[model samples]
Target chain A: MTLLKAWQMPIILGMVLLLALFLPQMQLNLYVQMVLMYVGINIILTASLNLVNGYLGEFSVGHAAFMAIGAYASSILTVLILPRRWGPAEALRVVPLIGPELANGVYLVPAVLVGGAIAAVAGLVLAFPSFKTRGDYLAIVTLAFNMIVKSLLENSGDIGGLVARLIAPLSASLSADVLRLSDAVGGPRGLLGMSKLTSLFWVCLWVIVSLFAMRNFIFSNFGRGVVSIREDETAAGLVSVNTCQVKVLTFVISSFFAGVAGGLFAHVLQFINPRSFTILKSTDILVMVYLGGIGSLMGSILGAAVFTILLEVLREVIPLVGLSEVWRWVVGPLLLVTLMIFRPRGIMGLREFKGFLPKEEEVKPQAAPAPP
Target chain B: MPQPVTTLVQQTLNALQVGSVYALIALGYTMVYGILTMINFAHGDIFMVSTYLGFFAAAWLLGLALNMPPLVIFLSTLLFAMVGTATLAVIIERVAYKPLRQAPRLSAVITALGVGIFLENFTLAVIGPEPRTIPPLFPLVNLNLSGVFVSTIQIVIIGVSVIVMIILDTIVRRTMTGMAMRAISFDKTIVPLMGVPVDRIISATFALGSAIAAVGGILYGMAYQLDPYMGIRIGWWAFISAVVGGIGNIRGAFVGGFILGFVEIFTPVFLPSSTYRDFVAFSLLLLLLVFRPTGILGRPIVQKV
Candidate 1:
């Protein structure tokens, strides 16, 4: 029993890794696999959003903006920047290492991280305004940020040309490449024909990494400062929490994870558009965050899973019950309303599931000295 | 070539027409926020529902084939939409918002968003996705004044909006109910102790706000296409207008609405395409928020340590 308890985390992680490696190969129904893929992406989105909204107590209604940034950045890399002749699957087919089929998955990590890094930088947009604004004003700032990002992409067609023209004086040949790259974004129509690089193993691996990263961050000293700021900003600052730094770092970290999810999402659909990351999409993330419970990591996982599955089930069941698919949209919000009315703090509220609790939190209890 | 004065005047008129509708809708947002301090995310959808109400009312009135005067048809449709939308807003307040009054503010905001989605999708499900418009109740007359053309519809829309604004301003500034509202907004806990019917006042706020949005809806439907999802974008714009002018402030909403109207109308003139309209509007909002966090007219919130 002692040995099992000691190895609990690794055992569970090993099991998840094993499952991810074989799940796609099981030949599950195509639609089922796609739904599972969405479930994974949404879980990542919910977890990252929870860091800012749940733990930090800031209402960011524009997480999708960061997701869009990540999506566009990674998609541009894979589809436009990478040499056409060096397609991952073809180049790695001869290498018998990590299985030729799975070798292509190697490129996806860096590409997605690059997307995330760019999105983390974009996080400054919200972080700076947050210094002064709070509540609804901050919410509006996030909403405006979402709109600005979407419109920026939508107008990228003209923007690209303008940039190219501006650069024409510097170097004619480089300007041509800049214009071509911008055209590849596909404007309002959306970027398409991305190589299907996202696999179950990669998604599972990233999900584990993100969940672990978020879990540790929340338990760290900085995370304590984040929660303190949420509870009472002035008090936190009085206590030497460095409230500004904590808030900015929290936003960036949250944005980074959201971007990572976006990268995976782009490759999953093998297409992306600005419209895909609208306020409505952000609202969907918000719904999941609230539904799961604020300030609870486990709640995010449960909320994302339940919300995604419920919608998928409704999509199937509504048509079977003599209602059109459009009714699912109506039913979805109706369910959310009922949920809100019943459980105002959400399912988990501020508590965590037993399995998700840190080892010391669950095991040591009264015997352990409280950290100062 | 330099821009002609006629083109500038034509655009200014267009801005006024759009601004009137935005100002009307922004009033609803500002009022509700003033009383409750909650963003009524569904207000835009209420505006949407009002337009549909106007559409059906106009359709039914014309279908009667009574040969009623055009003026009568327009008035009845407008009245029907206003009453119906007001009732809807009151019901939403009682059912969705009232229970969450003691809950966290974010919960109320989230519920408002859910209500918004429900309203939008409910409309989509029942009405289908095809966009609709109210048939013209009165004949339109385009009057050309020295190369600048103005339509009678534009005149009516601008005229009615200004009249409504004056009436609403008078009510909030002068009437007992408006005094109660302002008192409650100042201190909700103290006002009820002073004999204000808090719930009724809140419901009244929602009704008044929704009614004003209905007027804007009817006016907007007369000039533009109406769809269920129309509320989301327009609502956000009006919400921005409210924030830009300083939320919870009435006159500020008016000013912010016109600013957004000018942005929308003039964006295409300066930028390559109208696609940059949202970009410009949102950037303006960001800049304004950074410099004037409380908005143009909003008093800065003093943090109490």
Candidate 2:
């Protein structure tokens, strides 16, 4: 017990590292591996949403918009930038310096990072709207943003044509290339045929990094500013918190991780579509955030894990009860409603697991001056 | 080609019909938001469910084979849907919303979302994803005035919506229950001290909002096929209408709904396809929020320190 209290973080992290590195190589069922990957992706999503919704106390229902941006940004890079014949061996042979197995893995890192960077830029743009609004009004802005993104993606094909025709009168070659690239995105039909590069190790690594980043941010001065904004925005500004800067920074950081998760999600599915990133998908992330608890890192982790596992379990168990697969969707919402009614604050609320956190320094007793 | 004036008049007629349906649903959204300052996200789903209720009721009436008049069947089906939907809304308020009145505001919003999702999926599970429509309550007739053609259904939809709006406006302006609701919206804490039954008034608000939505459902079902997921898209559009017109303002919602209807129909005329409808509508909403956050008819909210 004493040893664990002293070195719990290192020990637990080591175990996770070992599991991530070896789990894919083990002879585990493919289904179980997929579920684990989903768990990791969902954890990243839940944590990012928590930063905005839970900590900042903003109700953003359009988080999937950023995810869609990240997914498309990364997918376009991996599919278009890479050579036509995409294989680890081919990549390694082309690069020649890196090992065959690690070649694509190394390339994926930059692609995902680029995706996050672009999503952060998008977040920066979105954060400006938050400056002028709060609460449900802010929610409307996010919702409109989501719809606009989806519709824009759906209309990409037409946009390309319109742009090409307009430019055709000016420059012929540029118009052709623009049209080709627009069609390549697949528009409403969806982008397809991306290689499955999202391995268990990479997913687990990203999940751990996201968790650590969120925890560090929450403990930092800016994080306190975020919480204070949630508690009372006027008061926080009165105290010279530079609330606008903090809010924008928080939005960018939160959306950056959400984008990273989107890249991972795209690779796992090996396909990308505007339909995948809708209001419904955002609601799924919100459910996970609220399920475990709000304003708690441990809660986000647990919430993501439990919600994902429960979904899988219901998918399997519903069939046994003589119900169709669609019943799972019905059951999921019912559970959420029940949870809200019974425990409005969620499982963890604002509390963190004591064991997971380092001990606070014990206050030493000073010599009392006889009932002074 | 037809005269441009003919096309304009024809489109305007179409827009008015669509706008009236949207106005009905937006009124529901604005009413709930006005009374509780909470977005009843489930209101859209309630609208969807009411359409289904109307569908089943019409189907059953036609199956009775009683040689009844179409107007009687329509009115009875409308009444059935209103009562049923109002009951559901009142029950939802009591069971789901009442307990969380004192909790964080977002909790109620989230719960409303959950309830909306549950309603959609439950309807899907029971009715099996197949879209259904209410049987025609009256015979279809086309009316030609000058060069433009209009249908009897369009006139009925527009006329019924206007009548409902006038009735609702009068109720809010003159009735005791409406007065209590307006008072509560002004100051929730003190209204009960003045002998208003806050809980019952709230339930009445939910019931009234839901009843109005039922009217929209029946009209919409007559015009288009009904599906469980139909609520999501139309509900969002109606919600946007309410927001654009100024949430909690009845007249604003009416105008906003018509504006949305015009946007929906006119986008296809100017743009290459109808797909740009959502893009135009949302852009309009975003622009409005940026310029006038209070909405057209809504009073500005004062931030208390």
Candidate 3:
């Protein structure tokens, strides 16, 4: 047991290094490399959402909004402020004397962290409203927040234009090119010329870190308090768990990681739009959290990897049936519907793998709780 | 820009027409939520299926047209869509929700969402993804009532919705099945002890809700093109309306639908462009929910100790 605790992080780190540093340099196709990066990103996303949905048992259907915020926040940074030699960010590159590759690498950590910080703040703002909203009402509020963010992004051109006009006179130096004001979000055409700063290395690093963080949190006293609250909020309050503080703190951390994942997504795709972060995207992440068995860190990791690979496999299956890419979408929902019917608790269904996680973790009474 | 008075009246009429469709669809959501305390996210897709049913019925009727009136053809399409969609709803409830009745609420919600995605994709795969325009049921006739020009289509939409709601209200209030439904919603265990067949009543609820939504789908089809994914956006709005009206309260759905309709239609007027319509509409939803979580017409139950 001591050996497992002592060496797990090192072993996982070594594997991540191998995959990120060595795998890319090896004889692998670009498609495979991209899928691997996405798997890493999904791992981060699923784990973060698992904190709220799995651990806290809050029905937040608007997680993608946080991701959207992170994406735009980081994308705008990379586009408008990062080193110019990379891409669209060149126009506003105030610094010099750094090599192009080294500059890109150096710029990524802060940009992504900034994204996480911004999203975490948004989560903090939402925490108060969430205290008043319970059950399905909370779900609707989150979903609305998501739509509000998406629609705002979609109309970002006009809104940006309005703001530019309002602020341009005050600050004479803030030119259109300086602000990249002409087409910051591209107004539904999506923003382009993003610095593809997302490396397999960064993704893998974050995924490992997030997993370790989540696992540790799950095993902590604070996590036990969160779980008790999920099991029964009123009961937990009676035991003096300070459920509200736990909920807000968990939400802030979860959304912060979600933002980090979104930063990865933007840099990898080299572009982003409002369309990419819809309620559907949130639903996709939710499916992973639920499928893996909520509150199980390892399950979230497993679910992300499996779901990502399943998507890739479905892509391969489409051409074999003499159909195009859209058919893959059809197959996915069909599979999900069937899977839910047979295994509503999800593929993991609260059954955690042993050793690191106890075997019989999540499989406690499947019956609905008594009416509140 | 159009004249203020003219635009005001026109938008109000338009809101009414749109609100009627929302009311019809919201009823389905409220009804299902009342009985099961589950959202039945696929309720929107069931409405989508009804549109296709309307399409095929119209095309089939065209082949046998013996100088039949347009109104007659429209009536048949409504009938076909209602029956077909109601059956689909029953199958969905039986397969997706029935087994998970005792599971955690999240499980049921996920199942419903999966079912909705399944229904949407299945239709898209079968019929191809291009939006199909349904043939206009009748020629558009504009009537100017005190400088307000309301089209026949608008009148028909509002007219049909009211009639259906009346029938539904009567069934819920004045029938044996309705009593069983109410009893089940209140206390399923005791109702079963009272010898009421709970399963059948639930199925009947599905049938009724789905049928009303089908009528909504047909009206929506007459105004807009038919697409498989149309249910998703529209379904969300109706769900919001249901919640805004107080989810379990039938009357709440109707009132909430109109309120949402006015907000959605009018927000674009005050805003710079219609792009933020959803943003504004949903913000309004959040505001309303903040003040009154149970909705305007919904009753709150005291938490059991």
Candidate 4:
């Protein structure tokens, strides 16, 4: 069968949609549901990150920063805009475009999309540097951006009050109270009072969307250009692939999806701190990407699901043995190390699932080869 | 006018002290990068573990003994910490890194990160989350220089760091072993043809770098309160310094460390608080990389087709 006739993507999408709608009915309790939600979000984060780390061959250590941007953006929007309770009668009066009736149900979808878009814009800042640098330097730049974002978030506040008055107009206030009204973000203590909008349904939905978009993008002309650049930038450039453009595009798209994942996480947990989006979180995503197998999208989803489940299982099982806390820090890193040592190519290498089975023409050698 | 001058001088000394520490750690980073082209992500955690070793030695081993003189106990504990840390570091390289040397850079890096996480969590589990008090080994004597009050320990930290750096510089330039190490760093492929024992040299490099980090860790514990998480922030700063100075250059690491330390210390004085210290250092690093990616003293890395 030709690549065009492959039903893998549609089948995967349909399976995901069905799972999203019905997985909650499974015998698993709320705790299990929350863990699955987390896994779904992580799947989005890891899969998107693999596009850059695996497919584009660029090392970014600040992927969590984009997630932070998305989380903060989505949370702020939800806090400021989402109506707490809208009855059927009142909901119709306030909500624009969709009116009060549909607003109660569909309002979240737009907010989440906007949150992802905001993260993509933030990603552009880091992506622009990829025009010149790659590899370790790119990693350092991303790490720096991560620190910068964290510090900025930590110090963001109003231009008044005791601490604020001291620095005043010259510097941003670090105190939360001074900027209470103006500051959409909840500086230092982090954004709070966010609604628990991230359900298993929403997370799985975005995970499906993120995976589908990335899968399609990878097989697209643009994705091929990215792969070409990854194989050899000089060669790609000679062949008319704009290496810089591809790099920036991949970074932006990856960051955008990472942000959406972040939004899902923030709403699910209903709390976020600067510590939540540290280099540790970035490492977590990187581990998932590498453990799943770098360039394989299916591997990323599998990796994220496995890691999330493993983490939850460890949390549940380790404490029972009286070493619960110790297990948290030890298990993840140990698995990563073991994986690198024993299976550095991960569960899969660069090859996707489609590459596993022989083509119909290959199975039948007498058949004429398909045209390019 | 006097106030500003005094503040400036004090900040400068503070920067020097911090920079000296960064320089000490950056040496380990630079040396490892120089030899293997692999960032030992575990280097920071190794430093963290060494600090805990020093802490344990000072608080439990030496601090308990009443018969021994304070100075002797301090000296012996420092030696023990350095040796223990060096051994741990060398073993890690031998077990974890040596096997992956022929593999991709990512494999070694991931393994290093794994080692780092393991070390950190192991310390956390063993020592508990509570920050252990590092009993002050050196007496806290203050010397008023012109007007600025300086502690004897701070001076000692600066002095020991400079002396060690000088010795290292001498070893690298004047000694045959150092010459061989340099040759290997330049091109490992040709070193075997030159009859140099490349594996031994690489292990020696790891031992030397780890030993330096252990010393730095001890001094760091003396300067500040010891904690398991201490290595992370300082490790990052040292990495920034290593990059700032030019990654593979030893002298550059020293220069970068001091420059970073001074910038971090003084920037807080001009700015609002110390919270932005990382931002400032990293921003400077980014700007420098944007302008001169090779770093201040680093030679431009030429890529092979």
Candidate 5:
């Protein structure tokens, strides 16, 4: 049953992709396309976050840390490897160690995958501590990880200096250039001068991939184990599920995708700063997950799309309506509180589209048995 | 030797002052966690909002319009800020949290995040994009206690914090409401069966927590000046303190705050580089969680079947 539902989503996704491809032409506006691109990135972010918060039942508030890792890693690679050209041949030559022929077509995808993998490694650092603590402790550990990442990035100059000193003997001839390259990482000032490689196609494609992967993970046997652990860890353990393994896996997978989303965002904005990835960003993702309904994959996608649009709309409409910027904060929380109070299960809860759709018999109504 | 001693004394006093503020904020976190088992992420933002409130009241309303004496103006502003923040806390509990009482803990956590964002952005909009100066209420006077030099404001902050802690401890131990709060924490379902008003107790808890947070906010504003983003860093520290001390343990929160404060202040001094302060503090927090999840003073909460 789940597989059939999963198969159906890709078809819908393909249709959406086709529609998005023609949207710019239809609307004749570049700004709208930019907004659409942003929405796609957010879709990737909120969907992947659902894997941890919704499917795994772990509260992770440091997702942006992974995002930062991915952003920096991918940005560094792209800046160093990719030639500053839009032509097919130049793009091909820039691909790392690949023959010029295949590089142009496949290099971007590989870069994104590598970025995600790097973030997954970062996730391990955060997940190791989770073996001992759960709930609020886990939340604090993750929060600390976020702050630590930010601080480290802000203080990357000191790290660079130490590395330079260590390698001074080996690279005496090229020490100055190496130091300059290290400074390119830009410490607290932030990473600048990166090419904007994130386009609508890449963003939308990743969003689809993330949505599909999260949905499959949630419905699979492993997904059931995650839910079981969430419902009752002891009971799940007694029933033979390795609760710890499930948690660690879920966290890593979620972190990997968050990293991918971050890379996409960094490329889209063409800038990377430590301040950009803070607890506030994590909170935004969390809000999307909860507002959509915990454990509901489709709901998360919808929630992210709605929220990104709403934020933009609010920014545009609020000032026109004579509401101050302070009012924006007021409205966001007010809406969230109202949603929690009235629809705590979110818009979908654990139920899915199939569950909501009326049965064939109900749709037809059996004609009331001809007034029997 | 004398110079080192003076430095040590100054650092110690600084640690105490900062630690007291953290303890005040952590109380709100610990108290709420004790009952609801939900981390009120917005508590830190509430602290931020209170500082702004105090700032506006002091600089704009009292300082500019009323032309009152600095001491009287400061006291009145502080009082108003506390009341305003307390009301905000109660409203948050009523609006954002009360509905999620029976819902999953995750939902409440998310709502708390939402509330926090709301408070932050609201302050940003109202306060503009600049950090405002808070007029000094008390004179910056220092005292030499033996070889240690401590500022008058620091001493006052520490003294008031201790008094507040003692008063809260007494109320929790010696009052009917405190018993009711403890009862609810243990088994919320049985509280109503025992004929207690659970809602009232929870509101009181929020009110009490918010009041303490307001004091912390005002003091923090006096110390560091006022800004919307000030709450973000301090809030994280306070949250860390609550967790390090054991989330639901009040006294543990106090101890955790002081420990964190000392770690933050002393790490920089000893390392001769302030850059690694966050690294050391965060690493310590993670290690503590791994070794003693319940913290120094916190007892483990037993999970029910």
Candidate 6:
């Protein structure tokens, strides 16, 4: 029991490593690898969103905004700036931990973390007004934030034009620099030509990390405080949980992970667009959180994984059944609506798998007498 | 650039025409929210479905016409579309939202989103991704009054909207069902004990809201064109209008819709960037929420410990 508790995380990480090592050897189709990579990225996104909407019981409809920020930040780092300064091989040079594609992704860790840090700051700024909102109102405010983020990014060209007119007195070089930065964003056409640094291994590794972090945190005292607030804010405040601070912290952490996922997505797709991070994108993540048992970390993993795969599979299976391709989009939401109507709690219904429980033997490690 | 008075009149009239439709959609949103305290996210999609209904109704009417006047054709199509949309609303409430009534608030909210997605995608499946042009429901006549040109369709849309809104206001103010709806909105759990048929009144509320959505749909179609995904953005604006006016108050919706419509229209006129329309509108919504969280006419609900 003690061994199992101590070894669980390492075991999970080891499995990810082994999968990474052998996946290339297996010679799987590139499309299949792409699907797997998507699953991993989605798992990270959905799980982080679950942290906000499910665990903290807050409505954060602007998660995709954080994702967008992260994508831009990380992509700018690895694709636009770093490659120019240190060359494409700099990433491989920094940490050649393995051969081929494995080492190719080594530099993404720092870039992705930087992206997460920036997004966490954005989340903090966004959460300032959320101190007053509760439930439905929170949902609306977050949605507005999503819209604002999208519009702001999409209208970068207009902003560039406006700035040029408004700051006509500025020195030519400085104004040129400002306009250059705006142009780099690619406006509505999207920023492309990013290096494909996101490997199946990197995504899977983060998926495990997100799961581990979320689960462990959710079981900690801080996580308990958040859950208590969800159950009753008044009672949690009476018990001295510092409800407002917890809410902000939860949002920051959740946004950070979402940022990480966004960075991975950016590198994987080798493209980023403001439109891809729309209100509908956020809704898609929300659907995953709802479909998964809210507040269950494992459920988040399952929901993102299963839903991602099912979507790809359904495209083929749906048409085979003599239905139009429209059912591909229709069936998912139809299932969700019916599910919410009949089983609103979702598949796991707030229950975690038994494996998540810390072993009884590990709880009193020093106190227990050894068998020897 | 300063516009001539005539052009200004034309712009304001156009604003009013657009605002009337928004008011209608906002009313549906406000009414459902008044009773359920749920946003009814699918309300916009319901409005979208109504346009298709209007299309079908018009086609049917045109086929079976005995040289029917345009006004008569429009009226019959509007009525049939309303009934059809109202029935859909009732069914959606029953299937998607009703069972989750006793569940968590978020469940109902998520279910509402799911219903909206289903409606949108289902419409996309049924109607291919093409924007349908509604045949002119009224004869084209540009009425020139003091150099201001106004289309006959715009006048009919505004006039019809005013009449419908007045009737709805009367229904809510004077009818027994309106009083019952008000009672349910105030205290949903206790209303049944007061001998009100809570379920039936709730159903009636859905029907009323859906009917308004249908009217809004036809007007929107007349003014613009129909697309499967058109409802989401307009629906969002209508929701904002409902919130600004006081979410649960019927009068507030109309007031809010016009405010939003004018803001959206005039912001681009004054500012060089038309893209900032959404940015300005949403900023206004956030500002309103911060100062008067309950909305302009909304009554605050005391938080229970």
**Candidate number with greatest lDDT:** 1
Best by TM-score: 1
TM-score-better candidate, 2 vs 3: 2
Model 1 in CAPRI terms: which quality?
high
Binned by DockQ into CAPRI classes (incorrect, acceptable, medium, high), candidate 6 is medium
Output the number of the DockQ-best candidate: 1
Off by over 4 Å in 1: A84-89, A363-372, B1-3
Model 5 chain A weakest 10-residue run by lDDT: A356-365
Q: Residues B101-202, candidate 6, lDDT per residue (tens digit)?
A: 888778888888888988898999888889886677778799878788889878877887888899999999899999999889888778899899988888
Q: How should the candidates be ordered by DockQ, best one leading?
A: 1, 2, 6, 5, 3, 4
Q: After superposition, how far is residue B37 of candidate 5 from its true place, in Å?
A: 0.9
Collision pairs in model 6: none
Best to worst by TM-score, what's the order? 1, 2, 6, 3, 4, 5
All DockQ scores: 0.83, 0.80, 0.65, 0.63, 0.68, 0.73
Q: Please provide TM-scores computed only on chain A for all of the candidate models, following their numbering.
A: 0.95, 0.91, 0.86, 0.83, 0.85, 0.90
Worst 10 residues of 3 chain B by lDDT: B296-305
Q: Where's the lowest-lDDT run of ten residues in candidate 4 chain B?
A: B61-70
Give model 2's DockQ, 2 decimals: 0.80
CA RMSD of all predictions: 2.0, 2.6, 4.9, 4.2, 4.8, 3.2
lDDT of 6 by residue, A26-91 (tens): 998889999989988888899899888888887777789899989988887886667767678445
- Each prediction's total of clashing residue pairs, residues at least 3 apart in sequence or on different chains, is 0, 0, 1, 2, 1, 0
Alpha-carbon shift of residue B245 in model 1 (angstroms):
0.5
**In model 2, which residue pairs have backbone atoms overlapping below 3 Å?**
none
Question: Candidate 2: deviation at residue B156, Å?
Answer: 1.1
Q: Write the per-residue lDDT of candidate 5 for residues B88-125, one digit (tens) a residue.
A: 99998998888888888778888888888778777787
